[model samples]
Target: MKFTLVIRQGKTQLIGQLKEIPGVLTQGLTIAEVKENIQDALALYLEDMREDDAEDSNAIIAQEEVEFA
Candidate 1:
């Protein structure tokens, strides 16, 4: 699967983020490096998500209500 990559100029390095996946972000010194880093970051993110789903399947889910200040 392919997703859009967004790179931004940072002070010391380039920052890259996956457009389709929030919180999947990383930084590298060069464009090539950042591109590579983002790929690894995305892979890790997907793996983590899959693990979470597996755990959720065995979890006893519940809801709670409380006032937020």
Candidate 2:
């Protein structure tokens, strides 16, 4: 999957983030390193999400709507 990579120049290093996903961010001294870090971060984030989904897959969920005046 392709993600939008946003890069910012920090005080001493380059900061990179996946624009599509919040909290998936990383820093490195060079853009190359930042790109690599972003990929790893995104991978880990997706893995965690998958695990979470698996854990909740068997849950019996219910939804209801409420009206407010």
Candidate 3:
């Protein structure tokens, strides 16, 4: 899976955020570092989403249905 990175050049560092995922942001001293940090942030973001889903009372794990023709 691929995600877009919106990076901004700051005075002291480069700030970046994943365009598709909200709240996944990081800062680094260089573009290379920012890219690495973004990967970490994306991983953490998805992991957090999974955790949140597990914690939700209304989350659906699976469903079965009969096929009719």
Q: Can you tell me which runs of candidate 2 are displaced by over 4 Å? A: 60-69
lDDT for each of the candidates? 0.87, 0.86, 0.86
Residue-by-residue lDDT tens digits, candidate 3, 15-65: 999898769999999889999999998889879877887778486777465
Q: After superposition, how far is residue 19 of candidate 2 from its true place, in Å?
A: 1.0
Models 1 onward score TM values of: 0.76, 0.76, 0.76
Worst 10 residues of 1 by lDDT: 60-69
* lDDT by residue (tens digit), candidate 2, 1-69: 567899999999999988889779999999999989998998899899878877787773763555655
lDDT of 1 at 36: 95
